[model samples]
Target: MSRIEARIEDLGLALPAPMLPPGNFKLVNVYGGLAYISGHPAIDGSTVLVQGVVGRDLTVEEGYEAARLAALSIIASLKHELGDLDRVTSWLRAVGYVQSAPEFHDNAKVVNGFSDLIIEIWGEAGRHARSAPGQGPSPLDVPVIIDAIVAISE
Candidate 1:
């Protein structure tokens, strides 16, 4: 197993299968040592795992779990595309969209779920630049939708 996969095991978390995009876009595109992953929600295949607006239908902690679910799937997609998690040299960037109530603005906290998961598995390699979580209606009404850019080796 790859080193990162081993860390995942130690963390007692298993990555879900690579998630399929809800639309026609590619899940990930790789070129010049970078992989661009499309937006991934907390879903399994076509099933929505978490939906609703943060601080309204769901609490901040709930939103965090939703983002973690998306992050798990993101790692799965990276494994599927690159054939090994160890191929990732660094996580470049991530953008997360959070669906929130009009009065709730803790967007960054919500996206930390996704960021924290990656860091848990890959440590420093998972560190990356992330935009302040964007808030608005998401494509599937999921609490969180996240995409990432990763630097990888051949």
Candidate 2:
């Protein structure tokens, strides 16, 4: 296994199967040594693992898990595109959308789920700029959706 894959194993995390876009957009676009990954929900073969709005239907913890799942899907998609996790040099940025009640303001904390996992797997290379915006609702009513930009080596 590649070092990156070994790290994931050490964390007891397996990348989920990469998901195809439900719509017409491409799941990943590579250019200029960077990969732009589309937003992914916490889904596995059309099953939405975590749903509903935070602070209402789910707790902050559940939202965190959902974001983590979404990040895993993103990593899976990356692996599918590059054929190896070791190709990744660094994460550039990530944006997470949180389906939340109006009173739920801890959106950044929710997004940390993704960030934390990335750092855990890639060490310093996984650290990146991030934004977590809370929305009233999302497609399929999932609790979280995440997208990322990563730098990759040839």
Candidate 3:
């Protein structure tokens, strides 16, 4: 196995089967030595793992898990595009959008789910600039959606 996939196995994690982009947009675009991943919702096939706004139908913790699931899908997308996760040299940036209730304010904490898994698998290489912003709703009404950019071997 490639180093990253082996690390994922060591972490007791598995990448979900990759889902195609719902629209015409490309799932990832590699250019200038960076791979741009599109936003991914917390989905396994057609099933939405968790939906509804945080602080309403879901707790902060649930939102975190949702973000983590979405991150798995993001990793799947990376694998689909790059063929080998080891090609990823560094995580450059990420924007995690949390579907949240009006009173919710822990967007960053929720987004930590996505970052946590990345760091777990890639160690310091996964560290990156991030934005965890609150949103009223997200595509497919998922509790969280995350998009990323990573430096990769060409």
**Residue 26 miss distance in model 2 (angstroms):** 1.0
Q: Please, what are the lDDT tens digits per residue for candidate 3 over residues 28-106?
A: 9999999999888887756677878888999989988988899889898889888999999999999998889999999
- Candidate 1, residues 1-154, lDDT tens digits: the string is 9899999899998888788766778898998989999988887766788999998999889999999999988888888888988999999999988989889988899999999999888889889999756577877788998988999998
Model 1 residue 88 distance off true place after TM-score fit, in angstroms: 0.8
Candidate 2 off by > 4 Å = none
lDDT, candidate 2, residue 27? 90
Compare candidates 1 and 3 on TM-score and give the better one: 3
Better of 1 and 3 by lDDT: 3
- Judge candidate 2 at residue 55 and give its lDDT: 85
- Ten contiguous residues with the weakest lDDT in model 1: 131-140
The TM-score values for the models, in the order shown, are 0.95, 0.97, 0.97
Query: TM-score of predicted model 3?
Result: 0.97
lDDT of candidate 2 over 69-113, digit per residue (tens)? 998888888888899889999999999999999999999988998
Candidate ranking (lDDT, best to worst): 2, 3, 1
